[model samples]
Structure formats: C-alpha cells, structure tokens
Target: MKCYLVPCVAGFIAFNENLDIVDYELFPRRSIISKLLEFEKGLTAEEEKIIKRLLKDYGKISIESVHRWKYGKFKGVILESPNIGGEYLRENLREILKEIGFIKDGEFQEIIYEIHMGMTIKRLEESFREQDKLIIQAVSTLDDLDESIGKFVERIREWYSIYFPELESVKDHEHYVKLITEHPRREDIIKLKKLPRESMGAELEEEDIEIIREFARAIRSLQLLRKSIEGYIESKMGYLAPNLRDVAGTTLGAKLIAHAGSMKKLALLPSSTIQVMGAEKALFRHLRRGSKPPKHGLIYQHPLVRGSNWRVRGKIARVLASKISLAVRKDVFTGEYDPNIKEDLYKRVSIIREKPKKKGKKRR
Candidate 1:
C-alpha cells in the first residue's frame, strides 16, 4: 500500500495563501433586520405574508445562534417553511418572554445574551465529566490496537501515587521509570537477574519496584491506543475543523459544522483549509458577493489542483466532490436527502450526458 505524505511546505504555502484569501479579500454584509424594516414600510401584501411567517416561526431560531446568523458570524442560515400552529405558539411564547422581562420593548439582544450565558455555564460545569468519558470511550474503541498500553499508563500513574508523595502524581518521568522496573513482568525480571553481570535491579531501591511497575503500565496503555488515538483525534478534530489539535489541544473539540463537508474529506483536508472554513464571515462574504467561493469547505479535498502529477488523486477528488455536492444540494446532512439514494441516482449523470448513436455507426 502507498500513502501520500503531505509536504510540510505544500501545507504551509496552501495555508498562508488561504489565510490571505479569507483575511483580506472577502465581501461585506447587509443586515437582514434593516432589509426587513425597509420592507415593513413598503412591503406588498405578499411580502407581509412572508414577514408574518418569519415572525410565526421565530422560536425555531435559537436565540444565540440566530444572533450569530444576524451578525453574519455563522456561515449558513437555513430556514424551514413555517407550519400551521403559528399564532397560538407565538402568543404563549410572548407571554413567557414577558414574564421573563424579555418581551416588553422587545429586548432581543438581552434575551439572546441571557440564553447564551446560560448555555455556557451549563457546558462549563459538564466539561470535565464529558472529557473523562471521551477518554475512556477513545481507549475502548481501539480494538485492533494492544490493550496493554492503556493498562500500562494507568498502572504507572497508580504506582507513582503509591510511592512518590511529593511529586504527588504519576505524570512525571522519574515516577514512570520507577513504576516500570517494580512490575517488570516477574518472569522477565527473574531471567534478567540470573545473568552474570546481573540486571539493573541492584541499582534500584525498594520504592522503585512499585514505581517501575506503574511506569510500565502507563507505557503499555499508550502503546495500545497509539494508532487508534491518532485516528480518534483526527475524527475528533473533524467535528470542529482540522489544525485545531495543534492550537487548542484535546479539550475544546473540533469547531467546524456539518455543512463544511463529510468526515472523509475533512479528514483529508489540510489544517489551513479547515481554519478558512471556520472563518464564516469571509466564506459567506465570497458566497454572497457572487464571486468564486473561497471553497465550499471540504470541496477542496478533491484533488483538482491546477498543477499536480497525481491525476488519480484528482479523479478521486472529483468523484468525492460530485457526491458531496449532491449531498449538499439535497440537504442530506439535515436528514432530508433521499433514503434510497443509490437507486435514485443510478447512472443518472451518465444517462443524461451519454452521446446519441450516429447514423451508420457500427457497434464497437
């Protein structure tokens, strides 16, 4: 099997150029509220109907997410058609807003801010537990990898706590070494001790045995999860964007949204591209300005560079892009794309583009 290693220079150059495209050459935004106000004064009855519909379904818009959408802080804003139960729900919702002092004079900003703050507080309180669970789940998912690696890391930490009080934790290097020797699989240690020059045991102190055991356990755990953890981190980062691991560590999670592209393309994208996608303001700017899009996110993952020897990679990219474009057009990410999608699209493109048979043309 062959693997393509992304050249450091290529990734860096692509990233810097991408940053320039986003940071300096994006378009301006026009406010929807301002547009609405203009329409309020001059709108026709049909326009009025649409405005009422928007008002009716306003609750579906998350207050904070909407605020971001309004300010053009988010990349996409998809609105579903309003349903029948509008007025009754709005009236009851208005009453609740009034009780909370958010309806009178209609302090939309204040209400949004309050909801955002509430969510933030809730998330902060839950983060530690969430992270611990993620760690365990990540460890368990690596079935093909060695399980001893995880056990080793755990035992190392445990032994450090047992022996070294001042260090207070097994995370240190000294503690790791101490733990490894202490629990050096007894059979292996005995064989080593029987040698003429003898093993390192003569130099090891009594406290070191437990510490060495703990160290070995820690190393073993790490070994078990090494490859899977790399894949896990890649998958994890895809949830946000690429390149975040280097910047944000393992805590904050990936920042990109689902529309950026599918997980496969995202995993293949360079970090710079991911960051560019996350810069919603710039991306939306290009899109709204009717210019060539900065890149519809993972669409760039298609191997269509202007100059590249890897024609095969480009073909693969085109196929992937075509599928992704179809997914996006159908709003499949939102679960609205066809369920029997395979049957629906069978040779659809080929059928449409196939050339007609010519007169007197012989069958090849």
Candidate 2:
C-alpha cells in the first residue's frame, strides 16, 4: 500500500525527510532489485556454465534482460507494462479527444474555423507527403541491396567457373558445389591479400566472393587461407619432373624387354650379363641403377646360355650372351626355328639319323 498509494507527493509538505514535491523522485523498485543482484556486463565461461545448468534444470529460465543480446532486440528497454485494461480504453480516449475539437458550424463560424484549420491541415498533409517520400526512399534502398546481393552471387558463380574449369557443364555441379562448400571465396578474400596479385588474377573470379561469403558464415572456417592451396600445388609440381622421367624410363624398358622375350627373362638377366654380352646399356641403365638395380645380372641375359649346365646362374649368363649377340646382329633376338638345323642334328645322332633318311626316301 505504501508503494502503491502512499501520499508520496504530500509527504514532502508534512515530513522533512529531505523531501519536497519539487524534488519528488520515482524510486523504481525493479531497478533497485536488479542493482541489488550481482549483475555483470559480460559473462565468464563459469557464469555461462551456471546459466546453462540453471536453464537445463529448470527447463527454461528467461532473464528478460538478456534478450537484447540478439542483433535487433537490444536497442531499447523492454518495460513490459501489463495490458490488463486492454485496447478499449485507448480507443475510447482517442474518440473523446477527436470530439473535443471545434465543430463544422455555418457561415462566419465555418469561415473562421477554416482560417484557423488551414495551416494545421496543410501541415498534416505535408507530413503524409513526407512519409510517402520516405517510403519510396526505403524501397529504393531495398532494391539497391537486392541488386548488390544478386551481383555478388553472379560474381561468385563466375569465379567458381574460372577456378574449376572442369565444372563447365551441369554434370559438374555436384563437384562445384562441393568445392564451394570446401573452399568458400568470402573467407578467402581476406587471405587473398597474402597471395600474389598474379595468382589471384589467374585463379579467382567474381563468383568466388559469394562462395566465400557463404563459407565465411562458419566462424571457424578458414576461407582466408588461399596461400595454403598455392603452396600445396607448388610443392606437388616440384616432384613432377623426376616422376615423369621415371615413368618414361619404365615404359621404354617394358617395351624393349617385351619385344625381346618377356618380363621374366628381363628380370632374370643381370647387368653383369648384359655388359659381358654387350647388350645396350642405355636401354636398361635407368632401370638397373639406383634403388632398383639389376635383378638378373649378366649371364642368362645372353641367349646362348640356355643349354649350358656350367651352373644355373652360369647357364642364365650364357643365354643372356646369346640374346645380346642376336640383338647386336639383328636388333632383336627372333629365336626362329630352322628345319635345316633340326635335320642336321637328327642326321648326326645314330638312331634318329637313320630313321629320318629312310622317311625322306618314302616321302620322295
């Protein structure tokens, strides 16, 4: 009752509690209560945890004060005065106020009223005109914002196309979308300053800005680290030269060895065998040297060592020698069968030699 209907205004006249109607103050209890509580400007992690725990335990605990933390809400005080009287009182007050004005009387009274009312009517009409102008300006500003946003999106698409040329078709949209999500351009723009101008010109297009903007929404996403990608590409290029040389060498070796016999013969032949048999070192050296070396060394790499039982390794070497000799003579070892050589060998053997001569007579 003291807070609600106490003669606070009259108290200044009766009691000298340093009070006067001239100095009457509105001592807001709510403000005082809020001040009494330990309020802080910012929350520490511990405080945040406490708040979250309270919220979790209580289901939902609203601190009406904290609603201002959002983008548009925090602008002003939200003093929630109750609407118990409803809107009826406000409408009645407006109608009564409207009726208190001068009436539209006849002749002299009307003329006098018009003379007085002209300026007020003109002022109100001018206010409405100003409102209309403001509305138009607002619409123009909104249109500009929309156009800017559209251009930003177009630029992002164009930039994406430039960077990832493989996505020229609709089929590549999935890959392009993935790339945009993975490496957005908006976050990248800031990091772009770190990259060389030439590199940016070579890679980024207008579309990247939109992509980056979209990616930038993820606060933790590092769209700005454009140099990292460049560094990776540059690093990869450094090893490309040596890898290409190795690939070429391996391919040439395969072709040459395949024409000679098969990979098995090539593997068994040693470098020592190739060298002793005078095989072309240029054709096999790149493969033989360094980490791989020659698996099969010198002997069996020669073709003549096939029948030699000096030792398994020695026979291999002899075969290698024959191959090398054949390669030198005909550029490749044909190992073609000759009937004359077979007949001569049969003639030399006692049992088979006689049978072949008798068979030859029967054929004649």
Candidate 3:
C-alpha cells in the first residue's frame, strides 16, 4: 500500500494514500537509451567483478507502483505520474547515496544493509513510455511542422510569384526550395534550370533574391528535419507496435495510439469503436442530430479506403478497422509479429472492393 519511487536521470513517482521513497538508484546522470544499451553491451568483467558484491545485496529491480500494486498489476492504474523532478526525485537521498558508494575498511555491508533494499528492474514504466511518448511526439510534431512549412512555402510562392509564378507550379516542395536556394536571382535561376520562362511577374533585385534564398534554405532544412522526424517515428512505431504498424502503417497507427491514449487502450477497443476513433464531431452529430455517422475517421487516409470507389469505401474502412483491432491486440497483448495480418488485411480489402454493390430499393 506504500508508494514506490525511482530516482535517477529521469523517473516517476505515483501519488497514493501511502508514499515511500524506494531506497536505491537505477542510474546516475544517464539516459534510458544509454542504460538499455549498457545492459545489452554489459559491464566489463572488471566492472562486473566490483559490482558482484553490490549485486549480491541488491535484489532485482522492482517498480513500487502505488496504484497498480494496490489494486492489481496492470488493472487499476488510477492516474499516471509524470516523470519525477528531473533534477532529483529525492534531494535528501543524495548525501546517503554518495556515502553508500564509498566503502571504508570493508564496511560496505554496514552502509548497504542499513537501507531497506527491494528490487532490480532495469528501469520502470518510464522507459517503455519514453519510447511511446517519443513516437507520439514525433507524430504530433509533424502537424505543427507541416503547418509552418506550408505557410513558409506558400509565402515564398506568393513572393516569388513576382519573379516566376511558373516555378511554384512545379508542386514539388523540395525541388522548388532547392531551386530557390541554388539560384535566387532571376537571371541566375533562368540560366540554371530549363524551367519555363513564362511569367508576367516583376523581377527582383539581387539583394531581394538573396533574402528570399536565405528563407528558402532555412525552409529546406526544416523539410529535411521533417523527413528525419518521420523516419524516427516509423522506427519507434515499428518497434513498439509491429503488427499495428504493418497493418495500419506508421503514421495512421501512431494516430490511433495517440487517439486511444496508449497501445493498451487501443488493444482493448472494439473494432467498431476503432473504426470511428477520430470522428468525435460526427459521432456527436449522429447522437445529437440524427445525422449520418462517419464511415471512417483518420483511417480513411488508408489507400484501401481513400482509393476505393464510393460504393466500397465504408466496407473497406470496416475491414481495415477489424484488421487494425486484431493487429493492435496482438501488438499489445502478445508482442509478436504476425505477417499474416498484413497480408490478410490487404487481401480482405481487395475482396471487399471486388464485391458487387447491392441494388438500391425503389420507393414510391
């Protein structure tokens, strides 16, 4: 019934009726990624030899989760505690921990045995959620990044409309930005690319074009940054939810996880609910105004649904949702990769598309 807390580079402390400081340090001034790698790489034999005695005293890492421990593991998590103060979870323990490291004249047991020790978990839920949060944040960042990039590009397009409106018609953001960066001047730009010279736009001075090029180069950097962020999100998503990633694709699967708040929640959802995850507005309308409910939410972005003819769109959404529901369950519950789900999902979408639409009833 006591609160268990981990204090390290970053950790969590749940608030319950009882709060107790767990006596130990997981890692000192190190990140979760490094710590994980360290375990995989393992300590040098010399280092291991030194910690052998310390390891003898320290049991496995046990996360003293106040909420989950009270009710049951994974069942009654009242509320998630944020990462404990980054600087230090417990300030007073600093002196004690520092002293504990120093063993004077074989008195290591005296210092170690004095404190009540319990667990040896590599880290806690923070490590798991750190990756989840990283993925979620990367996915979320794309929205703001997209808007900023779009606004910048749009402004550039309009501004450069004076120099060359035809350039904007290229519709390739990267290429367009590259052209601007490489040859900002009207005459130079004309010389470099075989692009059309047809524009009724006014020409700009070299000074003006240089300023525009500076902005274009900055925007291009952001475009590259956007691509990198997307790659990171995909990598994290694939690791965290391979089945979901395979079936739903990275961005959409991350969206579903974000909407559901977690993979656990998404796994628990019914296929019907998963189908309408982002349609809160339409769902409200269906309840409040007797309007037609949405057939798909964000998942409508899937090619199977978006590319389908109108007749089969809803069917595709339904089948896709069912597969996603299954995929997520396996991802959360089993943590195993099921290649068949991806194959079967696309197959089902194809079958659904080929099925002939039923005739509409003729009413008087």
Candidate 4:
C-alpha cells in the first residue's frame, strides 16, 4: 500500500510498492528548466502541489530521494523511504515517458539532450553573473603588478644612479620616478632638491636622458594602473563581502577568494583549512615527514596575527580564522553585515595578548 516518489526532469512519478505506476505529475514543457532549477535548490512549489494532491488520495506517501533538502521539507507529511525503486525508474525512464506520451518513441533521447543542454546554459549564465570572479582576477593582477613594479623600480634606481647617485636616497619609488621623468638632467634635479652643485656621477647625453625619462614614464603608468586595480578591489569587496572585508581586510580577503577559486568555495572551507590556506607546501611537508606543523599561513598577513607576540600568535591565528569562517558564511548565505563579528574577534585577540608569557627553563 506504500507509494514511492521518483523525481525526474519530466516531472514527479509515483509508483506502488510493486513498482507499478499509481499517480504522476508532469511539468509544463516550457517551465521544465525553471522547475528543475528549483528542484536542484530544494523542493519546488509544483512538487508541493503534486504531493498535496497525492496525499488527499493516498493519505500518506514516501519519497525515495537522496537529497537532504527533501527530507527537511517533508519531515512531517511523508515517510522517508529506502531508494528501492530508484534504479528501476532510472533504467525504465525513457520507456515510461514514451508510454505517458511525454515524448514520442523516436524523440526521447533527443528531448533529454535538449533539456540537459538548456540546464547547462542556464547554470553557466548564473555563474557568469556572480562578482567574485571579478575580485579573483583583480587580486591576481594586483599581485603581478606589485612584483613587476618592484623589479622595474629596482632597475630604474640602478640605471638612474649612474647619472645622479644622490637621487637613490629618495627611497620612495614613486617620488624617485617622478624626479627622473620631470627633471631628467642631473643639474636640474640637484637645483630642485637643493643638493650640492658638484656631481660625482657621469654626465649623460641628451639622448640618454630622453630614453631614461621615457622608461620612468612607463613605470609611472604602471604604478597608476596598480592603484586603480587596488581601488577596484576595495569597492568590490565592500559590495560583495563586507563582513569578510572587515574581518580579513580587502586585499587578504580577495586573495583568499582567489586561492579558493570562488567566494562560495571559500565559504565552504572549515576554519582549520582556512587557517592554512596558502601554506600547502608546509602542510604537505608536515604530513610526509612528521615535522612541526605550520602555525599560520596566509592568515599571517592579518595585523592581529603578525603583530602578536610569538607565544600567542598561533592562538590568535586560530581565533582569527574562526571569525573569518563565520564572516564568510554570513557573507555568502545571509548577505547581512554584522559588526559583532569584528568586535568579538578583536576582544578575543586582546584576551590572548593579556596572558603572561611563560618563562622557559634555564639550560643546565
């Protein structure tokens, strides 16, 4: 007397304990994609309506599904059943559709292919709409820019030092580049910066100064581009993951997302994994050699962990990672900005900092 529900792309099919078709509900042909999307997320309104109709006749029913979401929805109304009929239904699905006039005899495979293609396209569009991918690209580009700028700045310093060694003391790369581009002549730079008139470095030809000035201009453009990308990441992080931004800071949060491949993937990671995200090599070494495990990873970039005393840094990293985990989940699921996460993280970090340092035993 028990009835089992088997969900399919075409619709929901009911079969008796003997695997005989007892009741069924078919989705509208045009709405199958939408209904299937809803089903993938959980149960759909169509499913509820059909289940209610069946319950009126059968009193109670059973669902043979592996999806936990189904169990959550039907807890009180339906008995959770073993998947006894699932295999039979899957194997015989094409024939069942043909018998029920859902598809013509020759078109079952063709129709199924079309439905799958539609679902794939719909899912792809949804993935493209998310902004996390933009953040990943921006952060990756920013890191590349930082590396390239560092190398170029060093080269510029060395090359320009040949003509005006004193400018090397400027220290700041942007200011150094500005001086070279704006006042390529060593005498002009000395006059502008109020340095001594006597020059120990070699004098460069006008042609040589022009080339160095051109190179400095290019470096300046790159610096500007790097700044623009950083600004983009800050704004995107504020919009997409405010809680994660507040907890981890914009650049670190974006790096975490890039390392995980997506915000959703980052959100799925447990606190332990998040703590050691960028230290994969160290983790593997520990696993293979039984050496001391790393105390922190990319989370070490957080000021709380980096500035804490070595004795309590590991503890602070753990607390920070836990808060990051909560922040990520809230950002991904609730999208609500909760300031308490930041407050609680700082409070716990302060408590760890206050503990007295343990004195080590003196060597004999």
* Candidate that scores best on lDDT: 4
lDDT string, candidate 2, 219-265, tens digits: 11212122232333234222321221121122222233433343335
Tell me model 4's lDDT, rounded to 2 decimals.
Answer: 0.84
Cα displacement (Å) at residue 347, model 2:
99
Using lDDT as the yardstick, the better of models 1 and 2 is 1
Residue-wise C-alpha lDDT for candidate 1, range 87-196, written one tens digit per residue: 22333443433443434744533443344333323332344533323433343333323454445455555554443332333355534444344545433433544422
Worst 10 residues of 3 by lDDT: 116-125
Clashes found in each candidate (C-alpha, N, C closer than 3 A): 24, 41, 7, 0
Model 1: lDDT to the true structure = 0.36
Which structure among the candidates has the greatest TM-score? Answer: 4
lDDT against the true structure, per candidate, is: 0.36, 0.32, 0.65, 0.84
Query: Which residue pairs in model 3 clash with each other?
Result: 60-119, 60-120, 61-119, 61-120, 61-121, 62-119, 62-120
Runs in model 4 deviating more than 4 A are: 1-127, 360-364
Global fold similarity of model 1 (TM-score): 0.24
Error of 3 at 220 (Å): 0.6
**Model 3 alpha-carbon drift over 4 Å, by segment:** 1-130, 196-199, 361-364
Measured against the true structure, the TM-scores of the candidates, in listed sequence, are 0.24, 0.15, 0.63, 0.64
Best-first order by lDDT: 4, 3, 1, 2
